[model samples]
Target: MNSAANSRMIEIVHVNRTFQRADGQMVKAVDNVSVVIKEGEFVCLVGPSGCGKTTLLQMVAGLLEPSDGGIAVAGREISGPGRERGMVFQKDSVFPWMRVIDNVEYGLKCRGVPAAQRREIARTYLERVGLGHVEKAWPRELSGGMLKRVAIATVFANGSRVLLLDEPFGALDYVTRHQLQSVLLDLWDEGGAAARRTVLFVTHDVDEALSLADRILVFHSGHLVDDLAVTAERPRSTDSLLLPDMVAIKHKLLAHLGLEKRAKPLAIVQDGAAS
Candidate 1:
């Protein structure tokens, strides 16, 4: 990796998060975790439910403060939510009353972007996400996929250097999820190559993480368990070299949960073989 490639985009050093209950008992949501994501890198966090993946992402997004340690973006500590980091959740967060274009432009509007420039930027991103025609439609009229596209466009229009996605496609159907996966991949590739935006995507689907991430991080019991690099080329297909690696990682995660032997074995065959 070149110096620019090696430079850290997001760094979490000995980060830990704890929540206090009404009775004053402390619950550790995330344990001591250290990770360094490089500029323009696509990294995914995957683990079982309740493993604190979202909590970890929230800490990085500055939505929640950590109990210990620190998180920094581009060498500056993350104090609170800033325009430098954009986030999209599984829920459709777009304002139902606002048109798609207006919602997409809302971030810029808050930042005091002129109306003309904001419209231009929002239009460009909406088109990029294949929602150009729906700009005039309200969130209620758009399909689930279209709503997500609009949300993504909204985030991109903000000119954020980093993206934090927390299972952004989890609610969509299988086909829609796969389709959005490709769309997101294209967007990431375009943004990384052209603008060098770093992304930290959180998903539970093994294939989804394999298809999109340059590296995959496994979290278990509020701790990072593994960090595996995907060495395949860009535009990775289902038959790419990362498939076996993903399968292995999945089994490893199962083992960590003490269910490897009890779990059904994954069908492993040659690439492109019929099930």
Candidate 2:
């Protein structure tokens, strides 16, 4: 990778977004927020519901425009959804009418890549996500977890430099959620730093953020409250999370979520996501 590729890849400057409610009150979803994300970094945006984490992610993905300020990827200001960015939502994103392989290939097809070339790229990612055997299956035939695998494959096959995931695993069961997390990490770490994509993942689960993020951004009431770096080793485990340093980080995150007025055992904190 060249020096330019290693520089700041995402720049958000004093970005603000607001929405008007039914009663005619303008609500600010995102306040004056600014942050820089380096290339190839896996970052998590953590906060309770309606804290503007998802709203901020949408702005970065160019699915929604900010009321003021600006967001840029690489060096260009984002105007709308572009091929360089891809997003996966909490809800099922797979097309019900299309076969698994077709859904994975949709983005490439839209880009008008040669048919043979796109199919190969699609197949490669599908296999990487462990969905190769189901390429001909329908969305209805796949379980919730499998459907997410398809979505992951689609985003990667599209060759997006930035990946925005809005609680993509929030609805899954505990076991399945962890399994999918492993799959995501493996794919994200598959290549050299230059070949990796910059990921911004949003979740309310403190444990999830601790497990996946190189750094965690804590938001509350539409404000950037804290930005903490997770220095724990990669492939963090249940036991490692119980270590003194990791527990301290958990306490700090719980504090930001307004859940640590009184100190509690690490087990209690790990039991559930912040509410």
Give the whole-model CA lDDT for all candidates, comma-separated. 0.83, 0.88
User: What is candidate 2's TM-score against the reference?
Assistant: 0.93
Model 2: colliding residue pairs: none
The positional error of residue 111 in candidate 1, measured at the CA in angstroms, is: 1.3
Residues 101-189 of candidate 2: C-alpha lDDT, one tens digit per residue: 99999999999999899999999999999999999999999999999999999999999989999999999999999999999989898
lDDT of 2: 0.88
**Candidate 1 residue spans exceeding 4 A from truth:** 1-6, 22-24, 191-194, 241-243, 254-275
Give lDDT tens digits, candidate 1, residues 129-183.
9999888998999999999999899889998889999999999999989888887
By lDDT, the best candidate is 2
Runs in model 2 lying further than 4 Å from the true structure: 262-275
